[model samples]
Structures are given as structure tokens and as C-alpha cells.
Target chain A: MSLLSVRDLTVKFSNRGQSVTALNGISFDIARGERVGVVGESGAGKSITGFAMMNLLSRPGYIDGGQVLFEGKDVLKMSAREQRSLRGNRMAMIFQDPMVTLNPVLTIGQQMVETLRAHRKLSHEEARQIATVKLKEVYIPSPEARLDQYPHELSGGMRQRIVIAMALLLDPQLIIADEPTTALDVTIQADIMELLLEMCRSNMVGLMLITHDLGVVSQVTERTLVMYAGRIIEAGKTRSIINDPQHPYTQGLINALPQQTPPGSRLKQIPGSMPSLNAMPSGCPFHPRCPLANDLCRTTMPKVVQYADVEVACHEVQRLQSDLTSEAAQ
Target chain B: MLQYTFRRTIAVLPTILCLIVICFFLMRLAPGGPFTSERPLPPAIMANVLERYGLDQPLYVQLFTYLKNIFFNFDFGPSFAQRDRDVNDIIAAGFPVTLTYGFWSAVFVLVLGIPLGVIAALRQNSFWDYVMTGFAIFSQIFPNFVLAPLMVLTFTLALGLLPGGGWNGGQWEYVVMPAVALGTSYLANVARITRSSLLEVLGSPYIRTARAKGLPERTIMIRHALKPTLLPVISYMSPVFVYMITGSVFIDVFFSTGGIGQSFIDAAYTRDYSVILGLAILYSVLTFVLNLAVDLAYAAIDPKVRSGLK
Candidate 1:
């Protein structure tokens, strides 16, 4: 069985009079030790998926239907007390905006020690020692000095490292990092991703890397799931999805990437923005922007089609050979 | 830090100078001079009295002399009409009483207000929050006069539990009813501010981060949220403290307490120019100091603020 299996997860938010669906029955699984990247445009329910899995959805937004099974135990079915017990111990998650993630008034040492003490039965000194090791593991130089400093005393990158260190101290089974390095610069981004990947590799921990940057995802994640307008448009091994994208949305996302090959060549651009969830398209959400959209594509939603190891949700992909022929002709 | 403090202190100089100039002229413009009365004194006696107080000179000269005595000699002239005690002495005698009432009442408001607010915020929409909200509104609506007498009547007249008036006995009970009467309005204001600010802080990501760390809700609240939550509260406190001082004037009359408030009321009623001007200066100085303290507090709460100060 997969280490974590998210089945038919649907999350909704009701504001004023309308119920807006943030996650529309999306399903995927991460096997033990798997580095899975969930790539999507902003507002594509990527972060909401992670939040739903952790049962951390804020009020006005809630999990309407979902089964987030971790190691064969369904997370959504668990009682609040049971969920609390599992949250910081067995499973952990990090968020974007590291500057705001760590409390300003607290010393890094106090926060980390408190974090460790909360989940485990340990003395202050014991928790401090473990937290120090965790800090060292995340490659923070002068871990001892850094611990004594408050979040405001540290730079943004340093604070992010400290936040990551706190998450790693418990040695959770699964680490869901939601745009962890988005607020960071490119250089710090690479360092943080490398540190996270290295830690996961060393400890054989399952990681769900949620981000919009496919380049970052490609560097660390082995498998990639592309979500658009609250649904998984495509899913496969990272290479297959990137190189052989069957869904038009996935294809557009890949083509949009600036290529290293043929320097000075013009870059590809996705024609339009993703649709709003409140006034979403009639059937296939991406049909409005899909280049090869037909009457049937605009009228009916496509189901996830299992082709070998990958899943593609596009009606045109049914006549695969003819589509390949047409592409070749083009 | 030194530069900021120095700048702030220098900034208040023009303000103080302007206040002095305006007040000097404004008081002179009022219907009665220091010597004015229903029965007119003989011109000779009036001139003698004016010469005695150094008011025989030109207005500007008199102002300059007054300024010199105020700034250099550190002398607050004698009461304009009372003629019994100097303005400085009255202030000296009254300030400690003001401090006693203001200090205890301030302590009461913060201690009562902040926790009540925090509880109300945490239990948001629950029974206790609702009750506290009702009490807070009631405190504001119910005048200190009504509340004071009502409290004195209920606690002292009816129950014989506490003292009804001014600090007579050196006991906590003597202070309680008066302090409560004086503090009720401020307690309400502080509680309201605390509730709103805490609500905002509770929604911030750092608090959520603490919760995600699985820290107990109480620990998350008291440790993680409370301090930053207090930043706004502390900034607000200075003005509230000033308001408490100003508000105390009314409470003093109602409760028959001999504090700075009562003296201010008396000074205002009698149009004791020197005493009024002295009180004005005292109020200005206290306000400036309180504002400076608030800025220092802001620096501590937000490191960015301190760094920006550099």
C-alpha cells in the first residue's frame, strides 16, 4: 500500500451565499520514500489539497468529502484528539512565507524546544539537544548561536532554515512542504530544496512537494501531478509528464518553460489564465484555453484515463495515434 | 536610540513654547483679570497689586519675564486669584494623589481588561465572551457617578462590605470601590481593544504555526500569541493612561477623592490662571513622555522598527 493515499478529496468554501469548490474530488498517492511534486498555477487548489490532507482547512472552507489515508489509517475519519496526536508527530507540513511562519517574539530555541516537547515526552534540555541536531542537519551554520536568536534577528533565508529544522526534528513519516521556498530568492531556493531532498533521501521520508515552479520540482521530485482548476489534469513519472505531456494544460505548462537548448529561440506562452472556481467552465475547465478543443471537449468533462503508468485527463488522447499523426503533420 | 529620544524631546519644545504663548494670551483675553471682582478696587490699590505681581510692565515684557522664570528659574508663579499658595506647590501636593489614583486604576484596568479581552477573544461568541462584552458596554454606558454611588450604596450602604468614600483607612477595601469606579470606563476600553487586537493576532500565520507544532492551545496562546498581541495594547496604553488621568477629574468629584483630578476641576472653576497653566504644562509633559515610551515599546515589539530607526 502507498504510504499516503488521498482518495476523492473534495474541499469547499462557502462565502456569503455561494459555495465555491477549492478542491474538486482530486485523488493521488505517494508511496513510501517517494518524492512527489504537485505542480499547479496559483489558485489551482494546490495548497488547499495539502491543507485538506492535514485537516487544517480554516473556517468557511472545509473538507466536504475525502479520505486521506496515511499508512492505511484514514486521517479524515480520525477524531480531533487523534488528529492532533498525529499532526506534529507522524506527519508534518511547512508553509510559504517563512518570515511570518516563525513567531517573532520567541527565540528559535524556545519555539523548537516547545515544538519537540509538545509531540514527545522529553525534558527541556533533551528537546533542545534534538532541535540543535535538527538545525545542524538542515545545514544552518552556528546552530547554537542561531537557536539563541529570535526570528527577527535572523535573515529571511536563515528563518526559513530554522522553520524547516523545527519540522524535521520530529522525524515525521511524511513531510508536506507547501511552496516552502516561494518567498526565497533563487539561490536560497536551490539550497533549501537541496537540503530538503537530501534529508528526505537520507531518512527515507515521503515528501509531497507542492509548488508552481516545475524547474524546482524537476530537480527533487521523481513523480509529478499537475492540478488545474481544482482537478488533477495529468499525473505520471516526472520525466514522462514533462517530456510527453498528453493533457493540453500539462503540454502548455511544459512549453511555457524557458529552454536551454537553441539559445535565442522565442519562448512558448500559455494563452489565457485559469478559470475562477466560482464561475468555472461548463464541463472541461481547460477547454476554453485548450488549442485542440472541440464541441465534445467543451460539453463533457473527461475522466482520468490510465495509459501505462501515467494518467491523462483529455478526451483527444483517446485517439492517441491519430493525435500523434496530427502533431507530426504540424 | 539616543538620537531618536533627543529628536523627540527637541520636537516637543516648539509645541511647549506655542502652548505657553497661546495660553498666556488666551488667559489674559478672558473676561476677568487676576484682580477683577464685583467691587472695583481703587486705581492706586490696583496699580500697587499689579506692580506687586509684576503685571505693571508691557504684556510682552511680562511674558518674557514669566518665560524666564518658567524656563530658567524653574518657578511656577503663585496662584493668580487664590494668592495663598504658589502653583508649583499645589502641583507638588496634588501630583502624588494623582499618581495614587492613576497608578492603581491603571493597574486595575490592564490586569482586568487584558485578560478579560483575551478570554473573550478565545471563547469568541461563547457565553463568557458575551457576558464580558455586555459588561464592557455597560461600563462605558454607566457613568462613573452612577456607578460610584451605586457601588458605594450596594457595597457599603446595603452590604456594609466596603468603604463608601475617599481613602480614609489604609486598607485595600478602601481603595477597591473608588478604584473600580474610576477604572470602569478604562477597563471597558482596554478590554475592547484587547479583544479586537487578539482576534487579529490569532488569525496570523505564526499562531497557526505554533498550533501546527501541536503545542497545547493554552501554551500557543500565552507564549506564542500573547506577546505580539500585547504590542498594539502597549502602544494604545499611553493614550489610555492619559485619558485615565483626564477622566479621573470627573471620577474624583463623584467619589470625593483628593487627587490631581479634583485640583484640576477646582483650578478650572476658580480660573486660577497660574494653577491652570501649571496643570496644562504638567499634562503636556506627561503626554509627551507617554508617547516616547510607546515608541520605545514599538521598537521592542518589531525588530524592523528598531532597525529602521537606525
Candidate 2:
């Protein structure tokens, strides 16, 4: 059984005078110790999915229909007190901007110890000891001295590391990292991602990484979910999606990745911008941007179906697959 | 800290010197001699009066002598309006009364303003928020002179629970009207600043991070929100404090309290240059000092400032 299952989650936002749909019947699952990569462009409802799972969605935005089952318990049904207990203890979240994630006035150690004391009843001395251990886990040097230094004094990479350290301290079963490494330098990004992957591997922690970077999804995630217009258009094992993309949107995303074959080669990009949540295209949301779009694609939303361990939603995938096989034979 | 104090002190020297020079010259320039009372005095008697205060000397010589006495000896030459009474002694007697009243009002505004603002911001469109905001606006929009009399009429005339004006009955009760009159305006200012700053700080990402950490609502407010909100409030409150210390002439006059404010109004009416200039110099100096203290406070609250100091 999956450790966490989200069944037909749909989130809608009321804007101006209309009920705008942000997430449309998206569903997925995470097995124990699984690393799932949720890839989408900005406003693709990837972050919304993460927030919904945590029950942290902001105002004017509500989960109209969804069941977020964590360990077979419905998160939406949990009391505020129960949710509070689960938030910092059973699941922790690390945000994108490290500078803002940490309070400017508080010392790194103070913030860490407070997090510790919030979920677990411990003496100040015990909390400090745990904080020092977590700081060391994230490879911060001089853990004792760094504890007293405020957020302003720390470097960006160091602060991000400290945030990761705080998340791992409670040994949470699941961690929702929403583009946590996007703000870091390219060089530092690899290191932080490696650190997160290693920690999750060792601790048996399930990670839900939300990002638009396909390369990162390939490197760290075992499973990848391609979301478009607030819906998951394609999802499968990482290798299968990258090597043999079934959905037209997934193929476009992979093709759009910068090529290594030639320096001056023209880069391929998706034709149109992601549609606004205010007014999404009917039938299939990606149909307007799909090259393979036809009359049938415009009139009907495709159903998600399983084929060879991959779940794809497209009417023409079967025809395209056979045509591509014949071309490969030639 | 030393550099801050030295810079502030150096900047104030000119203002102090200008007060001394202008007060000395303008006092001499006032119409009629000091002895020119309703009952006219003879020339021989007036000459002795001028000589006794050293007004008989050359203009420049008299200025130099008075400057030396005030700046070096800390002497505020005897009051010409009231014989045998030293100017310094009169200021000393009156300054404390004004200071006490102003200090109490400052404390009252801070105590009341902060929580009211925090609650209003948290509640936004709620009932108490509207009530407090409306009350604060009404008190501030209505002039203190008008508000003071209304308060006296309500509490003294209608209620018959407290005295109307004077610092009579009890010390605490004496403070009630002046403090309320003074604090009503300042409290409104504090509330407005706090409300705006609180809203901005509440929207900051760190506040969300604070909430995500599962901190209780009250803990999040006092620890994470209040500190940054107070930064702007402190900067605004400093100037208000200085104004209160200098005294609001209308409130003093309406109440008939013999405080420095009343003395200032009397001096300005008669164009008593010594008293006017003395008060001006003291007011300017106090304002300058408070502004410096506010700067230090800014540095203390923000770490960027502390490192910038070095």
C-alpha cells in the first residue's frame, strides 16, 4: 500500500467574480521511501499540490474536493490540533528562499531549538544539544559558535543547509520541499540536492520535490509527474518518461531541455505560455499548445490510462507509438 | 556610541550659542526699562536697576558678560519681571511638572497603542477593530483643546467622579486629565503607525515561516511580529515625545496648571525674551537628544545598523 495517496484532488480559487479552477482532479501516490518529482512551469499548481498536502493553502484558495491520505489517515479530516502535531513532527517543509525562511532577528540555533521544542517536550539544554547535532548533520562548521549567529550573519548556502537540517531533525516520514534549491547557485544546487537525496535514502524519508527542472527530476527522482494547467498530464518511472515519453507535453518538455550535442544549435521551446488560471482551455488544457491537437482533442478530455508501467493521458499516443516504431525500422 | 554622542553634541553647540546671543540682545531691545512699571520710577532709581543687572554697560560688553555667566557658570540671570527670583530656579521648578506629565502620557500611549494596533491588524474588519480605530480617529481629529474641555465636562461636570482641571485631589487624578489630553493625540498616532507596520510585517515571509513552525498565535505575534513593527513606531514616537516635553500651550492654559507650558504662554504673550529663549533652547536641545536616542534605538533593533556602526 502507498504511504500517502491523494485521490482526485481539485482546488479552485475565486477571483474577481468567477470560480477559477487551479487543480483539476489530479491524483498520485507516494510509497514509503519514495522520491517523487512534480515538474511543471510556474502556476502549474505544482506548489499548490504540495501546500494542499500540508493543509497550508492560503486564502481565497480552497481544496474543493480532495483526499490527502497520509498513512491511511485523511489530512482534511484531521483536527487543527492533530494537524499541528503532524506538521512539524511527521512532515516538515523547506521553502525556496532561505533568506526569508529564517527569521532575521533570531539566531540559527534559537530557531532550530524552538522548532525542536515545539513538537517535542524537551529541556532547553536538550534542545540545544539536538540543534547542534542537526547543524553538524547539514555540515555546518563550528556548530557551537554558529548556533549563536543570527540569520543575517550566515551565507545563503549555509542558511539553506540549516533549514534542511531543521527539517531532518524531527526524522519526519515525509518532507515536502517546494523548489528548495532553485534559489541557490548552480554549483551549490548540486551539493544541496545530493545532501537531500542522501539523507532521505538513509533515513527512509519520502520526499515530494516540486520543480520545473527536468534534469533535476532525472537525477534525484525515481518517479516524475508532469503537470500542465493544474493537471498531471503524464507520470511514470523517471527513466521511462525521459527515454520514451508517451504524452506530447512530456516530449515537448524533454525536447526543450538545452542540448549537449551542439553549442550553436537552436533550442526548442514550447509554443505558448502556460494558460492563466482565470480561464483555462476546455477539454484538454494542453490541447491549445499541443502540435498533435485535432478536433477530437479539442472536444474531449483524455482519460488517464496505464500502459507498460506508465500512466499517460492522450488520445493519439497509441497511433504515434506505432508510427514511430515503423520509422525506427526504416 | 561615543562618536554618536560627540557628533550630536557638536551639532547642538551652535543652537545653544544662538539662544544665548539672541536672548541677551532681544531682552535689551524690549520696550521700556525693567523698572518701567505701571507706577513710573525716577531716572536715578532706573539707573541703579540697569547697573545692578549690568545693563548699564556697552551692549557688546553686557552680551559677553551674560554669555560667560550662562554658558560657564550655568547661571540664568535673575528674572527682570519678578525681582530677586533667579531664572534658572523658576525653570527648574516648572520643568519637572511638565516632564512628569509628559512621561506618564508617553507610557500610557505605548501601553495602550501597541496592543490596540496589533488587535486591529489581526482582526482587520472585526467589531473591536472598527470601534478602536474609530475612537482613535475621533480623538485625534478633534483638537486637544476641544477634547480636553469635553473630557473635563464629562468626567468632572457630568460624572462628578474626577476634578475638572487642576493638579488637585490626588497625584494620580491630577495626571488623569493632562495625560488623557496629551495621550489621546499621541495614542492615535501610535495606533495608526502600529497598524500599518503590523500589516507590513505580518505579510513578510518570515512571519509565514514563523507560523509554519507551529508557534502559538500569541507567541508568533509578540516575538516575530512586534519587534519589527516597533521599529517604525519608535522612530515616529520620538518626535511626539519631544513635542509633549516642550508642552502644548493650549492644554496647559485650559487646565490652569502652573506648569512650564503656562510659563511659556505667559512669556510669549509679554515677549519676555529671556524666558522665551530659555525655553526655546531647552526645547531644541531636548528634541536633538531624543532624535539621537532614536537613532541608537534603530541601530540596536537592526543588526545591519550595528555592523554599519563599525
Candidate 3:
């Protein structure tokens, strides 16, 4: 069974007397030990998906309709206590900014021990030992000394390592990291991502990484989902999607990468910004900026269709594929 | 930490000196003397009285002598208006009452105000939040002078559940009316501050991480949210606490509580130089000390401040 299966998940917010749909119906699944990367531009509801899956959306925002089935049990149907137990223990989350993830007033050890004791009945010593071990696992030197230090005492890279250690304390089956290294320097980001990937691989823990950096995703994730305007526009094996993008939007994202342009040449970019949720366009959300948009694309949302190993949601892709097949037959 | 404390302690000396000079000069600047009575005394008798207290000396001599006496013996001198009583004796007798009243009121402010604020912030736009917001606004609008009488009328006359006014040897019943009267505005201030600060903290990324950690709501609030929320509240409450202790003159008069607050007002009205100067110096010292304590508490609770000190 898949470790997490999020099907037809929709999240909405009643912001300022107007209903805003932040995440339209989207479906995906992660099996044990699988690593999936969710890549999108800002405001594409990437972080909201992580929060909604954990049932952590607060105020104004609500899970309008969805099924988040974890281990064959619907999360929406779970009692508060059950959800609490499943959280931190079975599924954990790492955040973007390390400085903000750890409580400022709490010592490193205290925070880690608190997480452990919350889900299990463990003595302070036992929890502290586990915390120290996890800190060592994240390659923190003098882990024992670090337990007594506060978040502000650590460097940015060290703080992120401490956050990762806290997330692993309970040995969660699935970890949802939302832009976990976005706040760090480039060198630190590489080390942190490598450490995370190695840790997940050794423990066979499933990871759902949400990021805007295509480079980071290509290195760490097996499968990739490209989101646009609150919907999944394309998804496939990371290698296939990166190498052979079917949807025009996905193609635009890959082309816009810095490496795709020659030196001294201006980089390519999508024509328009993502639409505001309150004033979203009809039909395909990406049609306004899509180079291949047609009449059907502007009038109706396209259904997802399989293109080889990839699933793409664009009418132009279907036409191109058929045209290529007919030309090959001739 | 030790160096910080020592530096802070040394910093109080110049503050106290400045306070002493200002209070002494200001008290002398006022229009009347301590012995100004309905009928003027004979010149001979006044001369004798002035000589008895060394008031006949030059202003600089008197000021220097007063400073010398306090520095060497810690004496605040005898009350010029009250017979056979010293400033120290009056403060010793009266300050305890004020402290008790202030302490109890602070208890009310913390016990009632903080939880109310936390709940209001957590609930946000709910009915309970609306009710608490209304209560906070109402309390702030009506100052203690206005609230005290209203409380007395209701609790003392209408319900007749408690005494209207009296110290009553620090009985719990006597304390209830005065504490509530003194604490209402402070409670309102604290609640409003807590609610706003906590609301901001609740939106922080750490709070979101806490929620994601699967910890219970109570744990997330107390463990993750409350400390940062209190950073601003602590700084705000320090001055409020000193104000409660030293600025309760109206409450003291209304409740007939024999606290130093009443003595302060009486000394001010009577133009008793020694008593007024002594109390002013005491309040200045208290304010400095309380502010230092708040800073130390801030450093202890916030890692950023603590590390900055190092």
C-alpha cells in the first residue's frame, strides 16, 4: 500500500468575504521509500498542499473537499487524538526557514525531547539520548553540547541540521519538506539536500519535497510534479519530465532555467505572472501565458492525458503527439 | 552575565543622584513651607522652629548636609509637618500596605488578563473573542478613578457582598475591591497587548512548524507561542507594575486603604519637603530596579538577547 495517497484534494480560503480556491482538485500518491518533488513558482499552492495534507491549515483556509488516505485510513475521518498521534510520529514536516522552524526560547535538546515525548511515553534521559543520536545522524559535531544551546547560538546551516534531526527523532514514515534549504547559502543548500537524501535513503522514509529550485529537485527526487496556478499541470519521472517536457508550461519552466541559456544571453521567461486566486481566468489557468494556447484551451480546462511515461494536461500536447505519430506513419 | 549585572548596578548611582537633586530643588520651588498654617507663628517662635530643623542654614549648606546624612546614615530626615515622625518610619508603616495591594492587583492582572488574551487570540473572531475585546476596550476607556467608585457602589451598596472601603488588616474581602479597582485598567492593557503579540506570533513560521509536528494545540500554544508573545508584554508590564505600586493615590483614597499611595498624596498636598523628597527618590529607585529586572528577564527568555549580551 502507498504510504500516503492524496486524491482530489481541494483547499479553499474565505479571505475578506470572498472565496479563494488556493488548491484545486489534485491527486498523487507516494509509496514507502519514494521521493517525490513538487516544483512550482511562488503562489502556486505548493506549501498549501503540504499543510493541507497534514491537516494544519489554520483560519480562513480550510480543506474544502479531499481524501488524504494514509495507510488505507482517511485522514479527514480521523479523530483529533488519532490525527495528533499520526502527526510527528508517522508523518513529519520540515519548513523553509530554519531560524523560524525551531522555537527561539527553547534549547535544541528540549525541543527534540518534547517532540519525542509528545508521541511516546519516554523519560527525559531516553528522549535526550535519542535526540543526541539524531543530531549526530545529521552530522552535528559535539551533539551533546548542542542540546543545551538555543537556536540563535547556531549558524544557519547548523540550525537547519538541528531541524532535520528533530524531524527524524520519531522516525516518521513520510517527511514533507517545504523549501527546506531555500533560506541557506548555495554551498550549505547542497550539503543539506545531500544529507536529507542520504538519511531518507538509509531509513527507507518517503519524502515529499516542495521547492522552486529545479536543480535541487533533479538531484533529490525520483518523480516530479509541476504545478501551475494551483493545479498539477504535468507529472512524470523526474528524468523524463526534465528531459522531455510535454506541456508548454512545463517546457517553459525548463527552458527558463539558467543552464538552458547560453552565456551572456538573456534567459527565457514565461510571458505573464500567475493569476491571482480571486481573479483566475476561465478554462486552463496557464492559457493566458501559454505560447500554444488555442480556442479550446481558452474555453475549457484540458484533461490529463498520458504521453509516453508522462502525464500532461494540455490540448496542444495531444495534437503534437498525434501529428508526430501520423507523420512517422507516412 | 555577572559583568552585565555589575554594570547595571553601577548605572543606578548617577540616576539616584540626579533624582535626589531634582526632587530636592522641585520641592523647595513649591509655594508653601511645611509649617504654613492658618495663623502665622510669632517671628521668635518661627526662628526657633527653623533653627531646630536647621532650615535657617544657607540653601547649599542644607542641600549638602541632607545629601551627606543620607549617604552616610541612610536617613531620610524627620517629617517637617508631622510631629515626632521620620520619613523612614512613615514609609515603613505605609509601603507594606501598598505593596500588598499592588501585588494582589498584579496577580489579578496576570491570572485573568493573560489567559483571556491567549483565548481571545486563539479564537480570533469567535463570540468569546468579541466579548473579551469589548471588556478590554471598556476597561481601558474607564480609568481606575472612575471604576473604583462604580465597583464600590455595586459590590458595597447594591450587592452588599463586600465592604465598600477599608484596609481591614489585609483581609481577603478588603483586598478584592481595591485590587479589582486598581487592576482593571492594567488587566485591560495586558490583555490587549498579549492578544496582539500572540496573534502575531501565531502567524510565525515556527508556530506553523509546531502545528506540523503533531503536538497538541495546548502544547503548541504554551511551548512555542507563549514565550515570544511574552517578550513584548514583559517590557510593557514592567512600567505598568511600577505605576500600580506608586501611582495608586486615587485608589487608596477611594478605598480608604492606609497604603503609601495615600501618604504620598497627603505629603504632596501638605508640602512636607522631607516626606515628598523621600518618596520621590524611592519611586525613582524602584522604577530603575524594575526596568533592569525586566531587561534581565528578557535576556533570559530570548536567545537572541542572551547571545547578544555575550
Top DockQ: which candidate number?
A: 3
Give Cα distance to truth, residue A291, candidate 2, Å.
Answer: 2.4
Candidate 1: tens digits of C-alpha lDDT, residues B1-310 = 8899999999999999899889888877887776877899999999999898888899899889888889897998988776678988888766766666677788999999999999899888899899889998898789787798899889999999987767553257766776778888878878888999999988898987876776777887888888788887887787878766554777667766666678887876677777888888888888888788888888877666777677
Colliding residue pairs in candidate 3: none
What are the clashing pairs of model 2? none
lDDT of 2 by residue, B64-175 (tens): 8767887799886776666666768778877877787788888889999988888888887789789878978798677688889899889999999777777653288887
The lDDT per prediction is 0.84, 0.83, 0.90
Models ranked on TM-score: 3, 2, 1
Which DockQ value does candidate 2 get?
0.53
Off by over 4 Å in 3: A324-330, B1-6, B36-40, B308-310
What tens digits encode model 3's per-residue C-alpha lDDT throughout A121-185? Answer: 99999999999999999999999999999888899999999988888889999999999999999
Please, what is the TM-score per model? 0.84, 0.89, 0.95
Q: What's the number of clashes in each of the models? A: 0, 0, 0
DockQ of each: 0.51, 0.53, 0.77
